[model samples]
Target: MFKYVYSLVFCIILGISPSFSQHTEEHAAATTAGHEEEKFDIGGMIMHHIADEHGWEFTHGVKLPLPIILYTADRGIEVFSSSRLDHGQVYNDYKNEHEHIVRVNADGTVNEAIHPMDFSITKNVATLMLGALLLILIFTSVSKGYVQNKGKAPKGIQSFLEPLIVYMRDEVVKPSIGKNYGKYFPYLLTLFFFIFINNLLGLLPGGANLTGNIAITLVLALITFLITNLSANKYYWKHILLPNTPKWMWVIMIPVEVVGVLMKPLSLMIRLFANITAGHIIMLSLFGLIFIFKSWAVAPAIGVFALFMSAIELLVAFLQAFIFTLLTSMYIGSAIEEHHAEEHH
Candidate 1:
C-alpha cells in the first residue's frame, strides 16, 4: 500500500512540471511578439506620412491630392492643357439621402463601409493661397493709402509696410540689380514676399510642401533663368560664346560655360527641395524612434529632439527663401549690368 501511494505522487509531480514550463515559454513568446508588433506599427505610420503618395485612403474619405499647376513639354516648355477641378468625382449628395461607405483591405481581410476621399481642397494649397491673397490685399491697400495721403508722413498700415519696402529697395534690389532696378522691383518684391510667406506657412501642421515639391521650385527657378537670359546684354552672350580665354581653350571652355548656365537653376531647384524635405524627414525619423522602443521610457527624449528640430526648421524656412531671392537678384544684376558700355570705353 505504501509503495503504490509513492508511485502515484511521483507521476503527478512529473506531469505538472512540464505544463508549468510550457506555459512560461508561451507567455514569453507572446510578450516578444507584442513588442515586435508595436515597433512595426509605429515605423509604418511614420513612413506613410513622410514618404510620397502610396494611394492610401483615409477612413473619413479625406485624401490630400498633389496639385498640378501646369504640364510641360519634353523640352520643358509649358503645355496648355485643361484639367477638371473636381476630376469628375462626387463626394456627397445633399438633395437625396445616400449611405456613405468605404472599404479597407489588410492582411487578407476586408473592412467594408469605408468612406471615400473628400473632394474638397487640401489645407496646404489653401494656406498658400491665403498667404498670397493677404499679401496682395494688405500691400494694395497700403499703397492706396500712401497715395491718398499725398506724401505726408505714413501711418497705420503704411507705417509698418514702409520700412520693409525701403529695406528691399535699398538692401536687396539696389545692391543686387543697379540703376535699372525699378523695372524689376515689382517682380522682385512679389517673389520675396511670396516665398517668405509660403515658407513660414509650411511650418504649420498639415501644411503642404510648397517649396518641397521639385516641380514648383523648378518653375520658379525657370522664371529666374528666363529673366536672367532675357535681360542679358550682348556682352553677357559674348562672354558665354567667346570668353576671355586662351585661343586654344575656347573649344573646351565654351561648352563648359553653356553647361554652367543650365546648372545654375538646377542648383536652386535642388537647394530648396533638399532643405525642406530633409527637415520633415528628420522630424518623422525622430518620432519613429518612440514606437521602435515599445515603451514610454524613450518617448520624452525623442519628443525633446523633435522639438529642437522644429525650432531649427522654422529658421531654415526664412533663410532658404531669403537666400533664393538674394541669389536670383544677383543673377539678374550680372545679366543687366552696363557691361557693353564699360567694354566700349
Candidate 2:
C-alpha cells in the first residue's frame, strides 16, 4: 500500500512540472508580443502620448461620453455633459471646410475629427472652480489666523503661511514693484500660489496638464504684459522711446528695445508651457518603457528607471513654478524701476 501511494505522488509531480513550464513559456511570449505592439519610433510615440483626446473609445460600436465644462461670460455657465468618444473622428477637417459634419459609419468607424474644446461638462468646470475655491479657502483661513493672533506670535496655519506671505512681499513684490507694490501684491500673491498649486497638482498620476496648455499660459502671460505696461510710469516709456544712448545708436536701439518689451512676456509664456509639457512627455515616455519592453525581466528593470525619472520630475514641478514666479517678478521690476537711479550710477 505504501509503494502504491509513493508511485501516485511521483506521477502527479511529473505531470505538474510540464504544465508549469508550458505556462511560463506562454506568459513570456505574451509579454514579448505586448512589448512589440507598444514599441514605435520614439518621436511618433512622444507625439501620440502628448496628443489630447476628446474622449475614450472602446473596441465595440458603443461610444462613451466625455464631460467638458466651460465658463461663458454672457451665458453664465454652460455644460456639455455628454459627447460621444470616437477615437479617429476628425472633427476639424481642413479638407472638408465647407461643411460642419461628423461622419459616423455603421461599423463603428468615424471619419470626423473630434476637438477637445467641443466637449463640456459641469464636472470639469467644477474641478477648476474647486481649485479656485481651495485657494481662497486656504488663504482665507490663514488670514483669519493672522487676525486672531494679532500682535501675538503666529501659530498653526499662520506660522506656516506668514513666512511665505512675507517672503513674497519683501523678496518678490517690494524688490520688483517698489514702494507702490502694495496695489499689485494681492494679484501677485494670488498668481504665485495659484500657479504653484496647479503645477504640483499636475505632478499627481492622471492629473491634467493645466500649465502645459499654450493657450492657458499665453493668457496668463498676456495678463502680466498688460499689467506691466499699464502700470508703467512716464519714466518707463521715456527710456524706451528715447533711450540714454549715442544719437546714431538710438536709431537702431529704439526698435530693438520696443521689440524686447514684447519679447519678455512672450518668453514667459513659452518657458512655462514648454517646461510643463516637456516634463509630462518625459514621464509618459518612461512609463511607456514597460509597455514597449513586455518581458517580466525587462519590466522590473524599466520600472526602476521610470520610478527614478518620476522622482526627478517631482522636483522639476516645483522648480518650474519657482522659475516662472521669479521671472515674472523680474519683468515687473524692470517695467517699474526708476531710470533716474540708473542715471546716477
Clashing pairs for predicted structure model 2, backbone only: 68-120, 68-121, 69-121, 89-112, 89-113, 90-112, 90-113, 91-113, 91-114
Top TM-score model: 2
Task: Quantify all predictions' global Cα lDDT against the true fold.
Answer: 0.59, 0.57
* Top-scoring candidate (lDDT): 1
Task: Tell how far residue 291 is off in model 1, in angstroms.
Answer: 1.8
For 1-345, candidate 1 gives per-residue lDDT tens digits of: 110000001112221110000011111323544632222454445434433331212211354443323222322322211122233222221110111122224432324433334332333455556776767666777767677887689887667667777877799888999989887777777776677666655555544556776876898899999999998998788898999889799999999999988998999889988898777667766655654565679989887877777778766876787788788889899887776555665
* lDDT per residue as tens, model 2, 271-310: 9889878877776665455545654567676667766766
At residue 337, candidate 2 shows an lDDT of: 77
Span of 10 residues, lowest total lDDT, candidate 1:
1-10
Question: What's the lDDT for residue 139 in model 2?
Answer: 67
Q: What is the clash tally of candidate 2?
A: 9
lDDT for position 209 in model 2: 62
